[model samples]
Target: MDTVVQERLSTKIQKAVRKTMKYIVDEHDVRARRFLPRNDLESILNKKRLEQLFRELLSNEYASDTATAIPTGSDTGSAEGHDSSIEIDSAVDTCVKATIGTGNVSRRALLALFLYQPHTRLLSLYVEWLTSGHPRIRKPSYDDHEIPCDKSIPFTEGDLETLNIPFTNHGYIMDYQTIFTPMTIRKFTHHDFKTRDRLPFLGAKEKIKDGSSGTVYKTNIAPGHWEFKTSDGRFLPENPDTSMVVALKIFKTIEGPWGTRDAKEVETDFNIERELLDSLRKRNISHRMIMLHWGSFSVRDADGIPSYHALIFELATFSLEAFLKDEECYRIFTDKSPVLAGLVDIVEALHCLHEHLGFFHLDIKPENILVFVEPESVHSGSNHEEGRKLIWKLSDFGLAREKGSTRERTGHRLSSSYYSSQPSTLPATRPAGLYQAPEIQSSSSSQAGPGSDVWSMGCVILMVLASIIEGPEGVTDLSSKLEVFFLNAAGKQKLFYVRNDSHSW
Candidate 1:
């Protein structure tokens, strides 16, 4: 190869190696921070050793290049050959000295090099050094040693070995399921409620509301005796009979041939909701905005196929729709301050879902906005509504989709009843709700995106603002005036919206 061309190729290869090293270092840094003590992790990624290793690697590369380039046979003993070898060695030494002297190689770069080439003999030496009882490398365990022995530190090497974790050829555990199971199990065991076989015993559920997709029921849970830390960093004992209520949402199941196909579809939707909620839980998103998912369970039919799917969530006081209809609660919204504050809260929740989590809650409506009243106010029957705290949370994510995902069509209502009547040409029927965006109304339009969710939220905010400004009577009057009647395929009058010249609602 031409000298210049070879040099260019080598430079590109070096750049690629450095980039890969950086990525590997970043990935391991994140994982190590979660499971390993900071001091121990820093020791494991020793900077001095990394710099030495990098210098040796560079020297070896240059030495190999010189060996391949030098003349073979009797010419190897010539003065010309000896001079060429000395010059190559001199250049390689200069480059190595410059790399170390300039402090160009960082600890991360060194760690990356080791991680990127784990099969290299150097990595085995590094591992041996790590296990040689270095003072900085403390034994893997939780920071606090005063805790009970039964409360084992999670994800330790011992624990991983006990679980018989499978490791890759590179000596790294790649089985995320086995690694995360311990944490998941710990979370469930330490949760506020106890369960039997991973299924919480929700006693005698009362139907709260009926929807096309499923029904929600309010039920009490058998509370566990787990102690939890409060916001101010104080541990508090949980009351076993403090009336811990939860919401149980059961997905609707069908029967027969068509129903059998529909059952699978229902299961798919149930899994989507569960997975989304689980994602939120794993990310530790604010429970004040997004409802906390406790657990999920399914019932199988005689053929051993799943028939009924249910999810357990933290119960809210009431839906925003129901709250507005209540004479007492409606009065609270009459004050513009509370209404504006509530709107901000809901908007922040939507922002978290859309921007932070990259999820679009396609079904945003007043009914899906759950309201949680302060427990003290609820029990004390406080007449001072202004002092009461109302937490607004976004719920009912059965129709939610991840941003940029187009594998499945959006806006399909979870109800089995609507499936038979759905038009074949359209991707899916728009959910039966007044808050649907304009793009969703047209059959030929593309799948609903993040903007669709914003539109629905805007509609909800509009209704909420109108209720606060004009009271319940004003909202009712406004709805009556905007109601447009149109004939459907069955020649029945259906309430719809007609766009004006400017395309405004």
Candidate 2:
């Protein structure tokens, strides 16, 4: 039900954001300034990087989702029927699900209302979302939407033991499910330093392997680990110990005077990217969906150069493209799920994000996703066992936007980074155009809202489904046509997918 509701909610938000973008642009254009952002995402991506992103996004859809993914309740007590038996199925593509009643939400809502006066309004929003969805709920408050208990709920867990994730003593899935069960529902467990501050490391940084994100410095605390990233997005910091990371950024004070609005656009982009990543995590959709994991922040300076930046996730493996085409991938890898399952999972992830999270994965091609090449055999949620669950993570969040937050109406709706190369015979697509919602191109940008993400997701789907359809020569054209329908209003409203004859999925 949550997933279903999420899809509807994400769609509404997308529409709303696009609508808001039009309003902002219309108002701003009176001064004769460009209303929409310019195209730029792909031009910056080199051949190697583009290839890598294309592959990773399609790799086994991340460790957290592929193996034993389960949705835990929002309540403090054990979810109803935690021990009850559920009907087992034999299909690998289908999911196993059972309704045990809405859990902690009933209580989580009550507690949120009482503890935070501002959140009481959320009850109304949730109720509306629960019943009517985004369009019906005109006034929604982003201020207090967090779950009150870390505010995230566990997604579907396929097979717990397969993932090697830990379980609580009472036999509950630990990380995927609520950390505290229904019985433990206290209003203020988040405030307990012991719980929030407990570092989630299993080994020392010196002993643990550091992937692309680069060098991890061990802290004095036993087994505590921190990865250092320099100002440049890459991992080349000499010593990240003295770095200073900022929260709500404070303006720089210059000797002359304060800078103008234009001066702050860079900072705004940086903060927006960071906050956007944080927002993704807060939504419980997995940080991999938008960018590399943003873990901790710190300062480090060993040489004379002072590098200030964020402490983000250490990738388990290179991106899906490199891992796939780079000869190195074969030496260290094993395979299990049929190619079909891999394609299915990527579509599933994109679908969930588009339909549930309310944003666009602007770059839907294969290179942006990452496939972890870890060792160890694990069972998939479908009762199939494979060696080392593939962890396909999402990356490169620079171009993401909230639902309905597009600016097409003022005629400058194109995104930056979509085009940089000199155009060939067939002109290259603008970044916004690469994933542009065909319907929205004709309609107002504001009306395009969530469907833009749907359009991008469709491009991704076309890419992945290419692997399934027959005949390599004509696959691209056929897949594009097939997927274009998926983005149409009739498709979304009726929930149609001709291939599966699935109207509600």
* TM-score, model 1 to reference: 0.51
What is the C-alpha local distance difference test score of candidate 2? 0.34
Per-residue alpha-carbon lDDT of model 2 for 231-296, expressed as tens digits?
575333222233222111111212222222232343344455556666777886553434444343
Worst 10-residue lDDT window for candidate 1 reads: 177-186
Who wins the TM-score comparison? 1
Give the Cα lDDT of each candidate: 0.51, 0.34
**Candidate 1 backbone collisions, by pair:** none
Point out where model 1 deviates above 4 Å: 1-203, 223-239, 255-261, 284-287, 301-303, 332-334, 375-383, 406-428, 487-496, 499-505
Give the TM-score of each candidate: 0.51, 0.33
CA lDDT, candidate 1, residue 70: 46
Clashes of each: 0, 72
